[model samples]
Target: MHDVTSQAGFASPDLSAFCRLDELGLVAVGQRLEPDRAVLACRVVEPDQWCRRCGCEGVPRDTVTRRLAHEPFGWRPTSLEVIVRRYRCSGCGHVWRQGTSLAAEPRAKLSRRGLRWALEAIVVQHLSVARVAEGLGVAWDTANDAVLAEGRRVLIGDRARFDGVAAIGVDEHVWRHTRRGDKYVTVIIDLTAVRAGTGPARLLDMVAGRSKQAFKTWLADRDEAWRDGIEVVAMDGFTGFKTAAAEELPGAVAVMDPFYADVLVMPMSVVFALLRGLSGAVRSA
Candidate 1:
């Protein structure tokens, strides 16, 4: 068998900079080479194990190897096979396993760094969940669930994300191009950054359906203070949207978006009348 302990010396390759297992109270014991990927075996650095129920020292028995998907190194996928020691409390006679920060929760297959990489791939890199799943070497449903759970915990669940709203925009978007069911959704945006000249607008919420009732219901769900802070609402030429704004945001000014006004406002008769006037002036000149 290949000795992993001998490879930990100075002559061995250093993966500490990228792996950073030390931060999680883990040390890389050895590496197993495979045709497709590399598996790094790790163990907790701390030798002493304590019992959770009673304040007593535990005796180390055997170890259980847990396989976890880790962040990729270069273009190749990497996995961590952690050997966690099982311990028996001398006083309480309780048995427990060693815990490390390598993974987020117990029985989770993805490491902490792997979870971060997956989130960045979806949010910052704009990659699909399937691609992220392939990179993490896991099933599609596993990757999707992990990414969505982490996203909700870190981003969507943030209470401060909705604060300081002064201006907004509402529009409808076609979510799906299918013949079966309703595929339209109402999109709400925070245009406060644009009005303040700070940054581009961001999507605030998306509601199902595209009607005055949908928009009105969304506005009604907001707090009174949030509703009162709206100073302006920009929308297209949809009369239903106008009516909804009038009912919900009576204090705010409703401005027609220039792009939509150009597309929906001018009639063919008005355009021909202006063209005739210009042609007559040119002929007289």
Candidate 2:
């Protein structure tokens, strides 16, 4: 719980912004929270958009419905009541109840605000799903699902915006629980000058595997225009990525830089030993 002093109130400075009423097609009807601030309630309405049926636009019908639950609203850590509507499409015989306009998907347990908060926890705070759930007072499954959904959204959104990328860096990371084996996630980084320094190094838009089909699909998904702009691809001598890069970006230069090994100066067998020694020293200290 947060304290409401003269300087700060229960209502967050960005509360209105988080609601994104205009974006959601709703105006903030009202807000209610006790002085102690145990809970905060908000009401939302559907906005004017095309019909889910015949694509005809709609106005607010007289009929309204009330939905109750905890909806994420940024880091305010409060609940929400998303009130929806019953819309009658003019173009077709469709009479359907409209869903929440704020969330990307209807009936999403996590609101857009909650999704942002959880993503911040994973990407910025570097907190695991279990820890985030404990802190946010949500179930572990809920937090984990939110993270996965948001991760996919980020990967898709960022990839869609990439254009005229001159260079790319590809790498792999292990992402399985309680496994020391071969499960991996392939991440494609935009090595373009504009995307330098921890920019868009998340998972690429593809299925995770070291197989030829996985890499091929990733390459095939890219626009042919991307191949023309790509000048170079730097990878850690992985034959799979190397092959894919060559086949997909025929014009691009492929550099199998051993520097990607992190300790290219040493043999692969000795690198693990070195890492263990470093970990042991840190633990002892």
- Over 4 Å off in model 2, which ranges? 1-37, 45-76, 84-99, 157-159, 180-182, 194-207, 211-213, 220-225, 256-285
Listed in order, each prediction's TM-score against the native is: 0.73, 0.60
Model 1 spans with C-alpha error above 4 angstroms:
1-13, 22-25, 45-48, 177-182, 258-285
Question: After best superposition, candidate 1 residue 160: deviation in angstroms?
Answer: 1.8
Per-candidate local distance difference test: 0.72, 0.55
Best by TM-score: 1
lDDT of 2 by residue, 166-186 (tens): 776666644443345546556
The TM-score measured for candidate 1 stands at 0.73
RMSD of 1: 14.1
